[model samples]
Target: MSLLFLAAVNVSPEAMAQGANDEVVREAQPSQSVQNVLREEHALFSDRLTIEPGISYSYSDRSNLALSGFLALDAIFLGNINVDTVESHTTTFDLSTRYGITNRLEVELMIPYVYRSSQYETIGAGASTGGLVEESVSQGDLGDISAGIYYRLLPEAEVRPDVVWNFSVRAPTGKHPYDIRTNSRIVDDGEGGFENLTVPTSLPTGNGVWGVSSGLSFLKTVDPAIIFANIGYTHNIKRSFDDIGSSEEDVPGEVNLGDSIRLGFGTAFALNERFSLSMSFTHQHAFETKVTTDGGPEQTVIGSSANAASVNFGATYGLSDTTSIVTSVGIGLTDDAPDLTLDFRIPFQI
Candidate 1:
């Protein structure tokens, strides 16, 4: 959601106005013209030798209602409805460096430390058990480490948008969710007896799978406004695990998570030379997940496909020539998305 858009803001307005003087110097000497041109050129995207360090904070809230389980015998049926809600807060510190091997090629490395905390609440009602609220808190790591490269295919022109091809590889560096055990106890049954009940534990910070992504990005500048769009696809590499159980029963297998397609477009308008505002929409569609058990056939997980969308509003303010603050709020546009998200980032260019 964040990019080094302010990398070129180190140039002062006074220096920009010196273009007239630089042009005069260029006309007087050919060798100085090369230096003058380099000084005048401002890169809107990644420039050579730019290293950016940033920290970001994000918060999101979500809720869902589902039928957890049911009991039936003969012609009688009993059902339970579980209302689940969660709120998560995450903080990530990342250092990203972009180096241009050529004017049209850039390589980037990004490393991140992520901390996350989430609160979970569940309320259930049924025949044997009365409605009760169970709550728990969990916190840990979040995203994996990743590296990327951007290759510019076409440069921006008066009528043509700049095009870039993006490729990235992700490593499983965070704590992966696996070998989880459920907490269980005897609870009051509505009929005065007791029933064994179980509740879910906290989630892990990573998926434990390597991933790769490729995409195409486009950008255009129109005076006071900039337009950007991208489409990407990500594939998660299948890996074997000791245990892959949703509950107590062990289901060891090689899991293949569903691949996803991401589409996004946005526009940023410069309110002034030091500030900008943006609005964007993002959508993702995940294919059905398939899991293959040891010596068993691959099975498609039911209800594993997901569609999520969000609308985001963002603003960026310059704190200095090398530092900036960026903030964004996202509203969910679909049931699969978080109800709301808030993010704040501070980035420094070195």
Candidate 2:
């Protein structure tokens, strides 16, 4: 891998775009999900309302300049390099919806229209300082919008016992504009740090932060080729009513991602008349970014706990008798998000 790491792996397909994270001091921000819902697949139909037209590819390499931790003594007050690495990417066009409003209740709707791209590099400590400074940047829009709701107080399909409850939201419309700064004062900070609470997650378009997610998930099923394993946890409460900045230099404190705990497990197989296969794993934890500057004084940063786990292999082809079609591919043992992903679903019954 060396066309410069294969063009950083084909620009990571998009690299989760827009300032892909790295900031701190906190004012409340952290709650972005692409369905870790116990590895997804729970709709025993009680009311029915499932509409999905999905296509997702989320890649992340997490690194956009470390300079040397805690701003590394202000990097000699800004002269040149010694940070090491940074990466990003994106690809989306999802239209998810699930509704079973009765038997334990349910509600969810997720929409993503991302086409983002990114790249950044810094490795200087030679030539007396100034040896390597990579450069790469890309853009695309119609991203940032995740809705949520789920309630299943026990019963996602046995385990010794089970549970589920949730709520999620992250809307900005996506195209950029929350604080987009960088003329080189140390560059890198496109509002992905939610302005300056240090960091939790953001990409800006218009007033962000309004995530209220609850948690509880447990399951275990292993029998005659219908195996299983699972665990989950969710917690987020960020609210920002809108304050672009310059109102004495807004801060609007309210952040929490110090890692909201989401650990998953997967295993499935029912290769029968139609066919079946599955795999799953998940993890979450990372936070401690404090940036309070309404009156100034509260600038902390040092975060690295956005771990990801995935492994899915599935297929179910049956196009008749109610119809059926499912395909999946997710690979990323740990990089927090995406190293590979491919999914498809189609179920009918009218």
Candidate 3:
């Protein structure tokens, strides 16, 4: 298990903060209010601009396999062993900059990196399973890359509060670092000890992820607090990594790619001008699978879908008029993640 929380560190989100007006934000310009910084503001510009470079840390707990039905079987078949099936703590950090174009239309770009360490006990399966040592997977460099654009629509309408339209993207940039596989089967429940049968015929591989995501977001002010929600679709391209296994005498690079869809909702509450908190939830479904081999025909694996759920909580505290400290935590309610996490951040407008 890693020490960092994969959920706590996202380079780019719909961008929820104090500035809900229609404007353009980038990653190069600096902000006028070094002490007054928006949690989601990132940009770099000449005149009306703001630039922020921040790092976030989080601790989390992980559990069961990400996929439920046959997909779980496939994950086990590949190299995604361990299946967690338990809770573990994690943390993360992020660095990014944003530029403000105008006040109504702004664009921001950010890149987040993470480090992690986790500890879990591997129980016994049957006479045919393998066991894992009760230890931890120390640390690593980075995670994924995410970016987004926000536009304050209905600026004049003000039907209720503030509403904005947003679009975002996520790229596969995390550590494909390898570790010893765990032996927790869906039926066993970590009872006895472990079995070698749980082990694949061969070694596992890394993750080759390339994805693009976009969604619509809304923000409404209730007193001193802002409630926001977003629903979007994440169409993940096929994975390019390979998993080589030995079916008796087959040593071929066996890897496949399939598309997936995800939906999410999040909100933030402000206590005052310098302090605020946020929460978010998201669900994912993996639909189809397509695989090709070295000396075999292309195979399309169908009739399988996996489901996942996630929750995130965070807070911001002002250090001065131009600098503030932020802390956040994340929980993988469902099997979609590895464990639970706690994260921290520091931001200031330049």
Q: Rate the local accuracy (lDDT) of all candidates.
A: 0.64, 0.47, 0.48
**On TM-score, who's better, 1 or 2?**
1
- Candidate 2 regions exceeding 4 Å error are 1-41, 52-83, 89-93, 97-114, 125-128, 139-350
For model 1, which pairs clash?
none
State the TM-score for model 2: 0.26
Q: How many steric overlaps are in each model, in order?
A: 0, 29, 81
Question: How high is the lDDT of residue 84 in model 1?
Answer: 63
How many clashes in candidate 1?
Answer: 0
RMSD of each: 6.6, 22.1, 11.1
In the range 1-350, model 1's lDDT, one tens digit per residue, is: 12111111122334333365566322121111111111111123435365556666656677676764565775544666666667677777777676667767777777777777776655663332345645565656646888987777776666777677778898988777756666654445566644334544665667689999988776665655556666889999998997878676788898898899998877766665567777788889999988888889999999889899999888777676556666778888887776677766555545
Q: Could you give candidate 2's per-residue lDDT for residues 18-112 as a string of tens digits?
A: 44364422322111110111224432323656566666665667554443324446554444435545466766776767677786767776766
lDDT of 3 at 9: 20
Sort all candidates by lDDT, best to worst.
1, 3, 2
Highest TM-score, which number?
Answer: 1
- Candidate 1 Cα outliers beyond 4 Å, as residue runs: 1-82, 86-91, 125-130, 190-197, 246-250
